[model samples]
Target: MIDWKRNFLMVALSQFLSIMGFAFAMPFAPYYIQQLGITEPTELKKWVALFTAAAALTLAVASPIWGALGDRYGRRIMLLRANFGGMLVLSLMGLVPDVKTLVILRLVQGALTGTTTAAQTFVSVQSPHNRSGVVLGTLSAAVFSGSMSGAFVGGLVAEWLGYRAAFMCSGVLLLAAGLLVLLGTREEFVRPVEENGSSMEDRARMFWDKIGPATPILALISIMGFVLLFDSAWMPLLVQEINGGIKGAAFWTGSLQAAGGIAGFLAGPIIGRIADRISPPRIGKISAFGAGLMMTVVGLSQGFWQLFAGRFGAVFCAGGLDPVFQIWLTKTTPAQSRGFVFGWAVTARALGWMAAPMASGTVAWMFGLRAVFFISSALFFLLIPIITLIARYLQPAPQPSAPIHAGRR
Candidate 1:
């Protein structure tokens, strides 16, 4: 049997470092752009949006292609590619002289790097299906913890040194993550044989034919996009409303956003254990309901305490949903196709991430920010029915299956 525990720890550590690197630099993009001579407020906002949209679009386009390549080659190599690509792109970003150059680099960064998703592919393929919930959950915790820590560190570095300096530091952190994965982890990846000289189109069709049956999974991924969208677009406005006339509003807003990450970190393992006991689908359904309830509370809050409590509870509950989805996907997908399937899964979720915030932000702009919360609450409640559909497609995890062996590209 493979030493899954050791491999899991190594990948988890790498994920933390990779995410930390990302949060450190990416959060300071607007500040960095300001230094590049775009001083008008409207122009700054337009440039920021353009930069963000550019990265998201490229990432969504590239993720599945990388995944298919990983299935053919090795996930380990793909992980390395993402890390090294990030390190190079982020480091060079500090050297660029203009906003256009920075935007181009950002586009390449998105196309080349998706460390978390690639790392998940590494872990999911190597892990036993029975233990996937706990494993993926722990991984999720690492991600949240790293992101929270990164934001704090990034803020400090940006204040003390400079945004450019922070970018260099971010590159160094990703270098560490890459070294950890390259030196410490092991994979037994085995490439599927191409029998009967199958054409590329035939193989591509075969891949989707297998994935096309899981409509519920796709829906859930889409819901998560909205979840992220609501959290990103409305949380700061919610904090501002709660802290009317308060000093250090910015600090409070940061803390409020960080609270969700903290809650996710603490909740991941606990939720994973619970899912392992009953079923992932059951846990997912309950979590969606809980998140919806908390969203309603947030919509109705009149004070900081109520809003804080609602945000914390909602994030804690919703944190479990990703692991549950991974568990179901792991049980249902074949070992050889997991890299590609997860690639498609990541791409699907990225589409949500890319689109949801824009849609919700427009709503908040037209109506009130509170309306965004109410709409998000309804979306989560709608997820309950979708969660129920997942159980229909799931099968028992392959408990005693052998690990995938390392194969040539």
Candidate 2:
């Protein structure tokens, strides 16, 4: 018998390192770009938008292919591919001579790396159906904790060494993560048998049929993903504005992001436990509203401490959104099709990720950086009613009892 708990622990640890590695240098991108000689505000914002959107676009295209491969091969191998690919790409990011090359590398990163999706698919496949909420939530907590540690330490690293050095450190962390997963985790994936001589169209049709039931849930996940990451690319710039200059801005940006990460870390498992018992839709509604309220506070705050407080509260509530939906998706999907479905799930979220930057970047360019927060807040609020509607739609129709039969006599 598989030791699922051991498997979960190992997967979680690897996820932590992977996310930490990415966060280490990524959150400092705007400043790094400044160092590359693009100092004008509008031009800077455009490049920042491109940097985030480019990866998301490619990830959207690539995730489903990778997911299908995961099912055909094994999820564990996919995990290894993502980790090692990220290790290669992120390390090279530090060596790029200009911002254009950096953007190109990000595109490649999106194509080659998707550690979160790989990790989630691996854990979901191994975990008990009944305990999906808790398992996934704990996994999310590992991600948040990783982000907290990475951002905190990375900020200091960026401050003392330079942004390039931070990226190098990130590469090393990814190397460690890749090794951990390779040595520690094991999967008993059995490949599904293909029908003899099935055409590409038949396979595509079958794929959609399997994933159809979860479409609404997938849509919600995408929206939430977009809302969650909408303001991230420009956050360092916001920190600079609050600090009144670029000097020491990276450390403070990292500190603020760390605050959010810590909040997410604390909130994930607790909310997940609650979701497993209580109605996940109810939890989702409450979390969305709370996140929106807190985001308003973040948008309106004029000082660093105020922003920090708001960031903590915002992420605390926002952290519950994805795992709750994931739990629902996990329950709805068949075990055999999970890798396939989750690949689409990742694609959906990547679509959101792709859109967020372009939309938020536009708002930032037109209205100002703070305006992006307000827009993000509104998007969160919009989810409340959407969740309510989706919950109602997903409810099974009441079945009518057959008429009482006289044949019993």
Q: Give candidate 2's error at residue 56 in angstroms.
A: 0.5
How many clashing pairs per prediction, in order? 6, 0
- Residues 86-119 of candidate 2 have per-residue lDDT tens digits of 9999999999999999999999999999998899
TM-score of 1: 0.83
What is the Cα-based lDDT of residue 387 in candidate 1? 70
Query: What TM-score would each prediction reach against the true structure?
Result: 0.83, 0.96
lDDT of 1 by residue, 304-362 (tens): 78887888888888888887777777766787877778888877777777676566656
After superposition, candidate 2 runs with Cα above 4 Å error? 196-201, 401-409
In model 1, the runs with Cα more than 4 Å from the true position are 28-49, 93-102, 196-205, 233-254, 296-307, 368-370, 389-409
The CA-based lDDT of model 2 is what?
A: 0.91
Report lDDT (CA) for all predictions.
0.78, 0.91
TM-score of 2: 0.96
